[model samples]
Target: MLITFKSKSSPEVTMYQEHAERILDVLNKNHTRGVITAAEAAHALQLLEQEVALSKLHPEVDAAHANHSHAHHLQDEDETAEMADKNHIGFAQRAYPLLEMLRAARDGGDNIVWGI
Candidate 1:
């Protein structure tokens, strides 16, 4: 499944469900249909920014977290080594589009909704 964020303030942004769910987790939102009203945009942005800041402060944790669920499935040396590679997408990267939308929404008093 895909999560398509709609906002009058910015272009639509689409993300994979997995990545979106992770973002929703960080935002303290349900991993389902929801909206971030203009009124709540600031707080949402702050939460996301804080998480991004924390991720930057602890890059290792970010990488580990991005792959945490998949790590347990590493059944071979090569797989484990591959998991160690620093190529996984971090929270910041995944959150960028939505973050931009949030910024625009916050500025324009627009609402962002997904799964509708």
Candidate 2:
């Protein structure tokens, strides 16, 4: 299944369900239909940014992803190819689009919502 994130400040960010759930996990948010209120957006943005940075510096840190890579083949062919050819699409890459949305929401003080 696909999950889409929306906010007044950013374009829609659509990702696989597993990917979106993982992002929500990283944000310490419930992985259900929900919203990150304007008041909470800044903190959520910070948390995700921190997790992304950590994943970039320590690729081995995301061990859960190793067991959860069943969806790897289902992702974009270009992305899969890029991962094989060069950079591994670790948590950092997977979380980038949502991170951008978080950043936008944080700056604009807009609520970020998903599963609507």
Question: Candidate 1: misplaced stretches above 4 Å?
Answer: 69-77, 83-86
RMSD to native, candidate 1: 1.9
For all candidates in order, the CA lDDT equals: 0.86, 0.77
In model 1, the worst 10-residue window by lDDT is 77-86
**Can you write out model 2's per-residue Cα lDDT over 36-83, one digit (the tens) per residue?**
998998888889888888877876656436334643564775555445
Q: Which residue pairs clash within candidate 2?
A: none
| Model 1 lDDT per residue over 1-116, tens place | 88899999999999989888877987777777899999999999999999889988998897777667567777875676586674677888889999999999999999999988
Residue-pair clashes, model 2: 0
In the predicted model 1, the residue pairs found to clash are: none
Q: For this target, which candidate reaches the highest TM-score against the unseen true structure?
A: 1
Q: lDDT (0-100) at residue 101 of candidate 2?
A: 86
Residue 103 deviation, candidate 1, in Å? 0.5
- Per-residue lDDT of 20 in model 1: 89
Best by lDDT: 1
